[model samples]
Target: MTPQTQPAPAPSPTQATAGTRRGRRPSLGAVALYPATFLALLVVAWFAVTTTGLVQPYIIPSPVDTWKAFTDNPEYLWGHTLVTTGETLAGFVIAAVVGVLVAVLMVYSPTLEKTFYPLILFAQVIPKIAIAPLFVVWLGFGASPKVLVAVLMAFFPVVISGISGLRSVDPELLELTSTMGASRIKTFWKVRFPAALPELLSGLKVAATLAVTGAVVGEFVGANSGLGFVILQANGNIDTAMLFAALIIMSALGVLLFAIIQVAETLLIPWHASRRNRG
Candidate 1:
């Protein structure tokens, strides 16, 4: 009698997931098509409304008018954009460094976490805009206040995400590392930090955008230069086209910062499941 052939083994979940990712990987053009389509629709709607006089030109300038505003004084706008960008970057860097360090400290010390977490939450709840003027008063009407506001806007999310990530390490894995005679620092560096990166990077992306808003808000309070200043000037003079142009530039700056963080996440955590799935 011929022996029955052995049955094939089922694919493991990991193998199945890997196969799914490979199958679902999107082409560059496919990935871009959705946003491009949406943007085109928006442009069509905008043109229709403006050309048909459904929306007043004073309230919502035509695309041509906005383009003219940019072309008219490109250098003036560029200088202000650079000023805002610098403030945003400076604040974001400071917030990131301080936030991570604070998170590490709180994680390592239960007493510190217990004492400071509530206070942190309280501070977070207070409107940063309300306190922004105070910073302006203290730091003066310069980049200092804008950067400070940005730091405040960005700091909380980083700290919260850092705490979540740091605490998520498996106790069993930690014990195993300890049993292997690994130092706490070695385990943390090799295992804990790597595990924490996905959450940390997510927080950074949010913080990056908030930092831009904070800079603009501070500029609104009092600024000689920046997109916010340009917007304020255009608003007072009823230059709707220039106002729209400044708003667009401000939005672009925030998007640019967010995209940079996304690129960083891709580079730093290519091994993570999120990154793998995206790929």
Candidate 2:
């Protein structure tokens, strides 16, 4: 006679505890260690290259020299940093606002998308630097041209990503909302806008970095102040250490802006898959 086999017994508390331990993810500090280690190694290599005279001081200044350059002209550097920062911030805000509105209009109207998308692509293709001087001529050497350059640099990414995000809502979900007799505007705010935030944030991160570049480019073309101007002056004077210091500040600025966007993304969409994965 065939006998029915008994089901396997549930795991014991001790076995379940061991399984949980084995499946545990690395802590945040542990995850951060890898980048910290690499950065430390890079700094060590930089110091060695300069201190050992492998590269001339004039060509590649030591970290100590770069630090001294900043200390030597604190006010000058601080003022220029503020100017560039303002330009970058203004450009980013304008891009985010105008780009999103344009994206919404385009998404709701196919004809607008077809008409403007190619024009945007065309504008993006033209070298911003080449036309930056024209803006200087139009708006003068003041901050307006620089801010405009930043806006142009940041605008494309926002519009592209905004359009993509706004249209990516699940059609079935949209239909479900429609069946519930929700107004189009109500459906958009409650469903589409929230659904599109992740993609929009992704674009904003890219635009943030590019905004720095745009501001610097505008300064390069014509500016009485800014990190770009400092770099240019340092190059003219053959002050490699000062140039390096300005470059370091610019890099830090870009990184800081990008980090701000990432924080906003986390706060705004804690439920997004990207944030969940990081957690």
Report every candidate's CA lDDT. Answer: 0.91, 0.91
Lowest-lDDT window of 10 residues in candidate 2? 16-25
Name the candidate that leads on lDDT. 2
Model 1: lDDT of residue 125: 86
Q: Count residue pairs with overlapping backbones in model 2.
A: 0
Candidate 2 wrong stretches, greater than 4 Å: 1-28
* Candidate achieving the largest TM-score: 1
Residue pairs in steric clash, candidate 2?
Answer: none
Model 2 residue 168 lDDT score: 88
Q: What's the TM-score of every candidate structure?
A: 0.90, 0.89
Instruction: State the lDDT of candidate 1 residue by residue for 29-147, as single tens digits.
Output: 99789999999999889889998999999999998899999999999999999999999999999999999999999999999999999998888888988998899889998899999
